[model samples]
Target: MNRLIVTGASSGIGLAIARRFRRDDWSVINISRRPCPEPGVTNIPCDLAQPGAADGLADALSPWLLDRPRLCLVHNASIMQSNRVDTLGSADLRATLELNLVAPNAINRIVIPHLPPGSSILYIGSTLAEKAVPGVAGYVIAKHGLVGMMRATCQDLAGRGIHTCMICPGFTDTEQLRNLIGDNAGTLAAITGLSAFDRLIAPEEIADAVAFAAAAPVLNGALIHANLGQRER
Candidate 1:
């Protein structure tokens, strides 16, 4: 079976992806700050929002390294603070980058060597990378950085038989989204109104896209948009 490490697996899209992978009998290493209750999902609790957290996570999972020849790394952990740059503090900026960009990059750097020659790395991204979402500057910046990282990884890993792909999704119905919008009903309404679909994309739909990318052997350096035509690339 294929072995995959998925960050942010405690809830939302991450949890959904983990569940789907487990159901497919893939060995799943679920990394998150909180523990998930899903059976067959190996929990690796680590805060991806800390500078040193990624290294710690890499060390923790080292012993469980698979004997197989392929390792799929899915980076889905991110923290968002919806506020303009003028209103946001240094701490907010650091927190957002640490979770959304820095830590994932660090984790990939440390873990890349352990992945077999033909392994693949999947970066979860957002449509905000291309469009200006008013209140989420930091998030947009980080995701944009992630896109660059994915492309660079694809180039660097090409000769090694390793591939990189970015999976960008529009607004999805997930626990994290619920938390973000529950506090501001009007903002949520405005966001939905901006969407041509008038509804949040399902987490399962995102998970399916991820699985498809993981299994597609020839999809190296591909940016798979799962936004239902919300933001075109």
Candidate 2:
């Protein structure tokens, strides 16, 4: 069976993507600090931001890779902190960088050696990488750094037949966004409708985009923008 590793599988787009892969009969291993309720997903709980987490996760997954024909690595764990550049604390910036960029890059580096040839590594990036908004200075910086990581990895690993890509999604209806906007339904509605596509993209929509990217052989090093037609550069 095809073996895949997905991070941040406890909720939102990660949960939905895990469910989709399970439904397709893929052997899905989910890594997260929280629990994923989806059946058929083997949960590997780890705090990705901690020291040695990448090496530990790779050790835990190495045995499974022995019998699998394929490997797909998806880095989806991210914590969004709302802080303007002027008001952000040093600790907040450090934590954001650890989780959003450094940890993912570490995990991918450790996992790559164990992957089969032709394996794919997918990074869940953000539209903010190109277009910055207010109150998320740390998040925007981390995501932009993540895009650079993806591109460099693609160039470094393409010769070995390992594909790397970035899938940048716009603001979507997820728990993360809900927490960011709070109970301001009017503001949320207005922002949702401000997209040129006339709607906020769903988590499942992004999950489908992930699946498509995984299946496309021509997509090595592709940086796709899935933003409901908004904030395209």
Candidate 3:
């Protein structure tokens, strides 16, 4: 069976990605702080916010990767608290960079060698990755760096038939958003109405895009913008 490893698989887009692969009978391994969403999928508990978490993820996944003909690794776990550029702290920036960009970089190094030909590496980015939004300096910077990482990975590994792509999703109606905005009607309306239909991006929609990227042979080194014209450049 084809093996799939997805980080932050306990919730949101990551959960959706894992579920999509599992639905197709792929062997799904999830790494997250929370418990597994389903019984069949294997869950590796991790706190990506902690230092060395990236190295730990790579080490923990080594055993499951043996002799696999096909493999997919999705980096989706990320954390960010509201902080403007003017108010951002050095520690907060370091933590954000570590989890959102640095850790992914390290984990990629450890895992890429074990992947055979035809493997896929997907990085989950944000609309903020290309565009700057006030009050989220850390997240914006980290995601932008993630895009660079994805592009470089593609160039570095494409010759070996490994495909790397970055998928950037717009404002999504996930529980994380709920936690961030709470019951604020104005913020909710503004975010959800970013699209032409005035609806928030769904986790399943992002999952669909990921699925497409995984299978599209011509997509190596591609950077896809999945936002519904939100903050379109």
Candidate 4:
């Protein structure tokens, strides 16, 4: 059976991806603080933000290293803070980059060696990755770094039949979005209006994009925008 390792699979878009893959009969490994509770999904409790947290991923996955099947690595967990550059602390900025960029890169180094020829890496980015928005300086910069990392990885592994792609979503409806918007209902309204549909992007829709990228080998190294035309880049 094909195997998938998804970070931040406890909820939101991550959880949806976990469910989607499990339904397709792939062996799903979930890395997150909370358990997925979905039948057949193995939850490995982890906090990606902590120092050296990603270093252990390979050992946790060692048993499956030799399973000898198609493999996929998905980086879906992230932290977003709303603060202007002048107000963002160095500590906060470091932590954001650690989780959003460093952890995923470490996981890539660990898992890439064991990935079979058809393996793929999926980096979940955001609209902020391409364009800056007010009050989210760290997130925007880190996401931009992630896109660069994804593209670099794609180039590095392209000759080995390994695929890497960045999927950028726009204001997806999820727990993270709720927290990002806080109790300010108007902020949510304003974000939704950025898309032509005038609604928040669905986690399921992002999951579908995930499925599409995973199945299409020709899309290797592609930067796919699933944001419904929120911003053209």
Worst 10 residues of 2 by lDDT: 49-58
Instruction: Choose the strongest candidate by lDDT.
Output: 4
Candidate 2 on 1-233: residue-level lDDT in tens?
A: 88778999999989988988787788898888998899888988898777567666667777777764778889899888779999999888888888888788777767877777767889999888776888889999999899898888888886777787889988788898888889998978777776887678898899888887777658887789888776332
User: How many clashes does each candidate structure show, in the order listed?
Assistant: 0, 0, 0, 0
Candidate 1: 10-residue stretch with minimal lDDT: 224-233
Sort all candidates by TM-score, best to worst. 4, 3, 2, 1
lDDT (CA) for every model shown?
0.82, 0.83, 0.85, 0.87
Which scores greater on TM-score, model 1 or model 4? Answer: 4
Name the regions of candidate 2 deviating beyond 4 angstroms. 231-233
Give the per-residue lDDT of model 4 (tens digit) for 1-233. 99999999888999999889988899999988888877899888788998789888777878877876899899999988887898889999999998999899888888888888888899999878888978889999999999899889987887888888989998899998898779998988888888888898889899889977887778887788898887342
Question: Which residues of candidate 1, in runs, are more than 4 Å off?
Answer: 183-186, 231-233
Model 1 Cα lDDT, one tens digit per residue, 46-86: 88887778776656878666475477889998866678867
Q: Regarding TM-score, does 1 or 3 come out ahead?
A: 3
Q: Between prediction 1 and prediction 2, which has the larger TM-score? A: 2
Q: Alpha-carbon error at 183 in model 3, in Å?
A: 0.6
Model 3 lDDT tens row, 112-180: 998888889999998888888788899999999998999899888867878988898888877787888
Runs off by more than 4 Å, candidate 4? 231-233
